[model samples]
Target: MTKISVIVPVYNVEELLPKCLDSLVNQAFDDYEVIVVNDGSPDNSQKIIDEYYKKYPNIIKPLKKENGGLSSARNYGLKYATGEYVLYVDSDDYVSSDILEKMYSLGMRDNSDIVVCRSYAFSNNNLEKIDNEILNNDVFKRYILNRPSATCKLIKKEILLHSELAFFEGHYYEDIAEVPAFCLYAKNISFIDDYLYYYLVREGSIMHNKKYSDKLNDIFDSIDNLTNIFINKNAFDEYKDELEFIYIKHLLHAASLRFLPYEEGLPSINKVCEIMKEMFPNWSKNKYYKKMGFKYKIVCSLIYKRKFNLLKKILKVN
Candidate 1:
């Protein structure tokens, strides 16, 4: 089997596909296969994949399927992954040339199931580490109660299969819905604490094109999926405080702001307010709640008090 299966799910990313493939082909390590799944893109991404496959037949493994979302493409790629460990990379994003070698070495050294590293945002020819926090307990602090992107980690194949770490299909926040199980069930988890993955932050990206609509409600679906994961693993009681804080962070704060610019989104926002109150009435007392900044604390306070109109007015002025 290959040492690492580098899965790249391609859609309409013809322009930036070359740079991403270039980084992978020049890796310091060679015992790896690049599974490029073209999810029915109407672009030249297939031709580019064919060119790379012709040049590197043994390294570039190509697959094609019907038009599926990001989660579907990743799941399709996973079915063909034969590597000891798996790594997901977006077609529009490029990684450091030495990333595969570095992560593989660390995973082998510790026999790790998951190896978490730092990620940077690349835009305007500049890069900055987004989650550079140095916490006491690294993996839990990084994956739980934080933005868990599937692109930022190297995962063991067995642990994934054993725990059924499949990405939730048809979900906008698939990583947040599925990533916690990787950290929670791993026998050993390691941290590189270095920025190796570079994600592109620009307009028209999947995250930047946010609108106040039913799709935004998928954040709540993600939370419910995660909550079920914790319950099935019998971990909810132990991590209830962290789970409660997630409700406060996602629904009351971040997801609430998605509706801030649209007056018609008030009904859905009020529904979210009811769920938050019913499920986590004592959320303000959660210890992790205090870890947020002053501004977020004020916003959550407003949300908890059912002051949507006043909260909307206050958020608009800022």
Candidate 2:
């Protein structure tokens, strides 16, 4: 049986796909299979995938499907992933050659349901490692909730299958909703401090687009989905505080985006603030709010006060 399955959701990243696939092909660990999902890109990405599939016929399996977003592509890939553990690698990002060996070793040793490693951001032809401490359940909840990207973690396949966890299809910011659910379902989790994943930050990416408000509804829907999951599992009381903190943080981020000197984001920001108040009527009194940094504290205070004009000015100045 394959020890690990690395799933790469290919979209239109033709230029960068070679780097990503090359990194996977050269990994020190060989007991893994690579599942590349071609999400109906109009570019030469399929040809590139064909080249790699031909070269590594035994290790690489390519799945071609219609244009579903990242979430759909990943969900489809999961169906054919017959590994004990699964890792997600974006088409535009690459990983260290030793990452699989290191993470898989630690995961098996610790019997971890989820194994997390440090990541680096590659921008402007430079790579800077992100700093992170060791993680326990308490620390993991707080840390993963804040940085909810799915790329840096290795999850047990059983956890996903048993919990019926899948990403929200056809949505932006889907990771924000899915990663936390994975963390909640995970029992024994481990972390390594080594920088194993390199996340590329480039223009025209889904995250770097200037128009943030277009996906605001999807973001809120993700939050609601998470809430429903917590409730159905009867874990709401146990995770209430953490969930509340995450909701508030997401709201503040949306609120800050409204300061982008665009009118389209204003209504979304207003709706975010309204939902924040409705959900946590006394949010200012929450312990998490009090422990936040001065900048967030001010933002929360201004949001509670409904001082959008002043908040916009303060955000602009900063």
Candidate 3:
């Protein structure tokens, strides 16, 4: 079997598609295939995809489907993947060529089902490497607790298949719903400290688009789906602490911060807090909550206390 299948879900990224494709084709590794799935982009993305496929037919495996959003495109690409392992890449972003070679090697050596590499956040002309100290199975809960996005991670395709997992289609913040469940299914994991993924932080991306702030409601569905997934697997209590942290981090704190920015954001923030109250009412006693930095503790406290005005003012001041 091929070492890896790099899944690139393409959308309307005509201008940036070449850089993403170029990065993959020039990888130092050769035992991988790039599954570039175009999601009916209205831009010139398909033409660019076709040109690249023509140039490197063996390496570039192209799949064209209707516009079904990122999650749908990923599910489509994954359905036909023929690799022992899978790695996801966004067409608007790129990755270090050495990523697959290094990650794949470690995955095989350790027989780890999930391999993580640090990601570089690029904006304007600056590149900031983001991540913490190296991790392993010792910190397994951390995997499900942090960095919910599945982008750039090398995962065993069997885990996805056996788990019968698919990204929650048509939902915003699908990563929140999907990534933790994937991590839960991982029996072994590995991490690389190197910045192997380039994450483009551009304006108008899904997370940054404030005009669609109402869509933050989708995060609720994502969180709820995760809860159901855990229950179905009957692994809820085994990872209950991590699950609580997911609710606190993704729904309460992260969503509140997003809503705190706008004029009518208080109601949204309130909605997030209400969910936390209903689901994880004793969440303040969470172990990870005790380990959070002073600033985050303050933020969580304010949110828990339902202090919307004070929380907004405090966040705005910073």
Pick the lDDT winner: 3
Worst 10 residues of 2 by lDDT: 253-262
RMSD of 1: 2.1
lDDT of 3 by residue, 1-318 (tens): 788999999988998999999999999998899999999889999899999999999899999999999999999999889999999999888988798899999999998999988898898979987753323255577678668878868999988775347888898898888887886678888877788999999888656765646677788888888999989989899889889988888777888777776767777778887888888899989987777789998998898788877877877733
- How accurate locally, in lDDT, is each candidate? 0.82, 0.81, 0.85
lDDT of 1 by residue, 120-182 (tens): 998889988786342535456456666568897899877667535688888787887788767
Highest TM-score: which candidate? Answer: 3
The local distance difference test score of model 2 is 0.81
Clashing pairs in 3: none
Q: Per-residue lDDT tens digits of candidate 2, residues 1-318?
A: 799999999998999999999999999997999999999999999999999999999889999999999999999999999999999999999999999999999998998889888899988799887763323357556555556787988999887775447988988778777788786677778877799999998877544566554665678888888788878888888877777777877665543454334566666667777887788676667666566679878877776666777877987732
lDDT accuracy of residue 64 in candidate 1: 98
Off-target runs (Cα >4 Å) in candidate 2 are 132-144, 162-164, 254-260
